[model samples]
Target: MPVAALDDIRAKVGQQVGTSDWIEVTQDRISAFADATEDHQFIHVDPVAAAAAGFGGTIAHGFLNLSLLSRMAADAMLVPDTTRMALNYGLDRVRFIAPVKAGKRVRGHFTLDGVDEKAPGQLLIRQTVTVEIEGEEKPALTAQWLGLIFT
Candidate 1:
């Protein structure tokens, strides 16, 4: 499944492709992220205080949810034979729709928005990502992401 041509890619509009991965938002993971980003917020790292404060448990950092895009995208976007390298171009829109509590499970759903030809052998793809948290009304995160693939 090499990178498709602009015309072929265009034909995929309105199509949705998805992959699900079980991700655990553990306390240790949250704590590590807090330390790495220097964001020692009690709501994210202090389980005891967070529980007492009414959240019932610690929460994951917003960026942690954002950072999972690559892993999720890898599962969703499939470019078989033709593409040699794929690079994260950037993101168009990103929103944290819900909180991801520690010890919860989350998964991602992807929908292809569009793909454009940037130059010869280069294509830019735009995809909408929805990260769902088990038993949650709102998704953990919703984002429009971009990628550049070279053939």
Candidate 2:
């Protein structure tokens, strides 16, 4: 994607930036996340047990779902043309509202919330992200995400 002017990016504050393409949260992906995090909870790795427990089947971990924001942002975020790099600053708030079931598809809707000039050529950008689960009434998660953009 082509870079955008800083003014153009700033103008997007308080408006929806973009919606990312849907991403399938498969069992394999969940298992991989469980392995990486060493969190093999039944709800996340054991389908039969999870089904018996009323989750219907294995579900993705909340952190796994949260981590997917990186991929989602790459597909839909706006960047300043003079940017040297962008860094994950930190999240101000994050809430996992619903579980993401295995084999379900999810996508992110991003809205630019605020922007501050932290330093010369350095900007702190805040975005509100909502991760929607396909065919679900409620979103999987919502977060106030932060990024440090170095121009």
Q: Note the residue pairs that clash in candidate 1.
A: 1-80, 1-81, 2-82
User: In model 2, which range of ten residues has the least summed lDDT?
Assistant: 1-10
For lDDT, the strongest prediction is 2
lDDT of 1 by residue, 36-98 (tens): 999998999888999998889898988998887777776666452467788989898989988
Give the worst 10-residue stretch by lDDT in candidate 1.
1-10
Candidate 2 clashes between residue pairs 3 or more apart in a chain or in different chains: none
Give candidate 2's error at residue 107 in angstroms: 0.7
**Model 1 spans > 4 angstroms off:** 1-10
lDDT of each: 0.81, 0.93
lDDT for 140 in candidate 1 is 91
Put down candidate 2 lDDT per residue, 1-151, tens digits, no spaces: 2368889988999999989999999999999999999999999999999999999999999999999999999877887889889999999999999999999999999999988999988899899999999999999999999999998
**Could you tell me how far off, in angstroms, the CA of residue 19 lies in candidate 2 after the best superposition?**
0.7
